[model samples]
Target: MKGIRFWAFWPVAYQPSSLQASQPPSLFGLIGRRMTKGQRRKLNRIYFMKYCSNCGQPVIHRTPPGDDRPRFCCESCGMVHYLNPKLVVGCIPEMEDRILLCRRAIEPGYGKWTLPAGYLENGESVAAGAKRETLEEARAKVEILTPYALYNICHVNQIYLMFRARLKDKRFGAGAESLEVKLFGENDIPWEEIAFRVIHATLLKYYDDRRLGRFSFHMENISPPNPNPPKTDN
Candidate 1:
């Protein structure tokens, strides 16, 4: 456990193999309770694509004429329904030496700490989405510094992209989607309350690069059965 240490971060998200001591937080592990709306939504990709998008028709699960993967094919219309991973965009907003974090207003990790990130809405660039999320959750403007981390949570079909940003001012408060928002220095980060592994991984990388006086982009697959999908809009 002593050897497994990471600089704590709020999630935009985590990956598994990087740690020897910790596993991703699981909503199911908390208790053998029913899945929350947030948890259930993560699996919506599997169950929700019941109709064809191109034409309003019930879809059938089958491997279409030539495709190797099973798709939701419309019997009435020739359209196939394909489910893809959801993209979440956020940023590591920094003020002086502190970083901003939001207490989730929604579940699977309700009340947990996370970076200011959410699903990228249609017609928005990655950079725009990241900056918008920061403002929406933390109520703060920022100067996006650079792209920082990208995490793929295959099990839950989510990809989180996080950026490095400079907070425009210190006058931020919790947004409507957040319970509370706060800033913390590196050592003061709330590791146990962290919302996702991807966020944690991104934070560790941020501090490492800061110490080296150089920030570099990172990409990693946040391994399987990712149970801590945010209940928020993402």
Candidate 2:
């Protein structure tokens, strides 16, 4: 019985020779896989030598080797490109039975509908940033009721925090960043035309959760659609 079981599970447990083969090569992988230790060190000395990404100045000796990964120092601007994560704040503001939406006047998705969202300013709280963005884009004052989502967008290196908010006053108009602003009920929302994958996904989740008479938050990276990319330069 043990032999029979082992035979039966062998295919499942054992990796095939083809599957065990090395990873498909990339530029970095090929360099890493083929290079000798000395060659790798030479490559590292050439490519990974400390250089300020901000000012393009060499920063070879400043950081201690024990640090493993150290940020470059820029003497000219006193800047460091530490590659910190950016904070993005968004809000789903509701009034009565309708939700607020804005048509962007900025690049990346001009004239497309979206939830009020933007990068968090320095020293601003996530909720404060969300409320501020709502006011800035839609000219509407919002009271944050609860968090709606916390997403990590790795491609852009941003951490997004979304909130469910209540509009203090329904009176709103388009702000400088927005071409138009309006409230839409579930049926009236332009499902097909909504901009920003995160916004669309949040709305769908919102409606789905609403049907169950409950509110739940979601967190995921929703890549931006390229069909109608922002056309600020044009």
Please name the candidate that would achieve the greatest TM-score relative to the true structure.
Answer: 1
Write the residue-wise lDDT of candidate 1 on 127-224 in tens digits: 99999998898899999988888898887789999989999888899998899999999999999999888888888899999899999999999876
List candidate 2 stretches off by more than 4 Å.
Answer: 1-64, 67-80, 223-234
lDDT of 2 by residue, 172-204 (tens): 999999999999999999888787777888898
> Residue 193 error for model 1, in Å?
0.9
List candidate 1 segments past 4 Å from native.
Answer: 1-45, 225-234
TM for candidate 1 is 0.74
Best lDDT among the predictions, by candidate number: 1
**Ten contiguous residues with the weakest lDDT in model 2:** 5-14
What are the lDDT scores of the predictions, listed in order?
0.77, 0.73
- Residue 70, candidate 2: Cα error in Å is 6.8
